[model samples]
Target: MQFVNSKAFAQGLDETDPLRSFRSQFFFPKVRPDAEYLYLCGNSLGLQPRSTRTMINEELDDWAKYGVEGHVEAKRPWIAYHENLTKMMAKIVGAKPHEVVCMNSLTVNLHLMMVSFYRPEGKRRQILIEAGAFPSDQYAVASQVRFHGFDPNTDILELAPREGEDTLRTEDILSYINEHGEKVALIMLGGVNYLSGQAYDMVAITKKGHEKGCTVGFDLAHAAGNITLELHDWNVDFAVWCTYKYLNSGPGGVAAAFVHERNLDKDLPRFEGWWGHNKERRFKMEAEFDPIPFSVEAWQLSTPPIFLLASLRASLKLFDQAGMKSIRAKSKTLTSYLEFLVEDTFGSRDWIITPRAPSERGAQLSFRIPKDGHGVLEALRNRGVICDFREPNIIRAAPAPLYNSYPPVPA
Candidate 1:
């Protein structure tokens, strides 16, 4: 592909982008009335949609007008509210409607899924995970091992990148799986490494895990709205993700869980709540727990926060309109442009730690500074370029294709 200078290229790409106009739909943070910060942090928290306020207001109006009767009398009807979110989410993740549900937070759902699928038996008691998995996931896996009467230190097998390497190679990951697969009961990994922005090959990993009679799951916190996924087609056993990041739900918005249709009726016990009970018989308050017979619905533990669900409903609609394919295309071009700018700015002196191949990453770029990295990040922030700082020496910048513009990449 022929490249253009940063400014011209950004303008040209945005002009040609079919979804470029969607940027006006969001509420960009403006520290100065005349200026907007370059927001490249959607991998951490997405820019809020302008429609979020109106959607949330509608729910508030219903709550005030109908009070408790809002359960059924509200315009969207709180009683059947979560159902409204299913189809869009299913489409985004490439799963059947019955296989996806918006439910508890990411960590909570991970534990619940573990309760059902991480059945430790005989010598097959280990949980295989990436060495630098997200802290929450690491804690969850460790706790599960301890809960099951196993030593976590020994039971949790984390595969680290080879010495002096920055990213994990697919061959290395597969080799670890092949070596430890027979002993592993579960393989839970982040769909995209949060700090490095490396997108794992989920299809190959899932296939290999199943071949060894192990369940496979993903923590798609950074990957959910940033990339294209085919969880069902990949035959992934289960997956969980939070919406606050790329999904653009508000902070701590309810997360989602996915289960392949094949495992919906396997009789594997889960830690359930009344929401997981069959809807028709739930109000009867029966003594026995009879789950709703769907992979995703069966994972719900309580009534989801209606206000948060309202925000997600608005965001998911935006996603459906733009579609993941188009979003990813813009993401690749925009991020590649930013990477080009960064390299051009520092020439051979600065390092871009994120994968150079667009196929291997999402929209985020993790740039490393050999000197005064934190100070440089602060300087960028002072210049009205908003990104994040990781410990040691990396600034993680994500140009959300939906909201970021070209001027900010070099500014």
Candidate 2:
């Protein structure tokens, strides 16, 4: 679809958007008494769903009335609450219900998946990762290597772009994997990079890593719900993500993980907790660790925080209603329109580091700022454009399919 740069054209698109009514379901930040903020920060933290309070209050009321009995007596039983979420969560990630479980936050789950999947030994101890990975992921991989008695400097392969480029090229990645794949124990990447907003070709990458005899996985913090995924069909080894962004869970909300069914009950080492033990035999307080067969719940280490799960459930319900296909349909259009607007306004004066092709990105358009653009974000903030500035010189704007429309032109 050809995109126009005029506000009238943008409003026309908004008026006909299939997902337009979804904008009313979220609570946007109010930057002033005069008007609402044009929240373009879903890549960071999504606008809160207005139903969050009612959902939380249901849990509160259950706790207030049922006391300890709420564990079994709440409208949604606490013992089985996480189970209630698996089907929808799996659909969002394109996995089987048993392969996915909503659990710990992103970094924590990454470490957990590494425990089972990143079994480096002999000549294959190195982890292949992006150079500018989210810092927590870098730290997580470093510590995992150190924990296994390897020098992180030697064990972590930080893949970088061609000189003066901002994003990794697919050909470069495949070529690197072909050359050094045998020595690498794992290939972990953010499915959609947080900074450049480039969505990797997971299917091709996963196949390449596996052919090279490496465990292939992704951190879906920015990918889950933002794009279509097929962890099961892609034969992806594992993945982890935080739900606060595109999933629209609250701040620091519960995250989730996906493990291929082929790996379940394979005698892998995992950090065990009572919750991971077989539910039928759990109450007996058996000393033996009997895991839930064929389920990713085997990796869970503790009782889930039901409040966080409930918040995510609220968002998942919306996802269930909107279907991922519809979500992706609107997302491509919204992000393409966003890219067109940014380029029309700034032209070549500012750089758009994100991939221009809609197929290679999600809902975000990241613009590299000029040296004098330091105060630009602040001005946008004051004018009610809610975007985020990354260190050095990047301004990230995400027109979330759920709650964002095209920004009105600057006067």
Error of 2 at 247 (Å): 0.7
Model 1, which residues run further than 4 Å from truth? Answer: 409-411
lDDT of 1 by residue, 268-344 (tens): 87888888889889899898988887556877888879999999998999999999999899889888887877667
TM-score of each: 0.97, 0.97
Error of 1 at 20 (Å): 0.7
Q: Tell me the tens digit of each residue's lDDT in model 2 across 78-191.
A: 999998889999999999999999998999999999999999988999999998999999999999999999999999998899999999999999999999999999999999
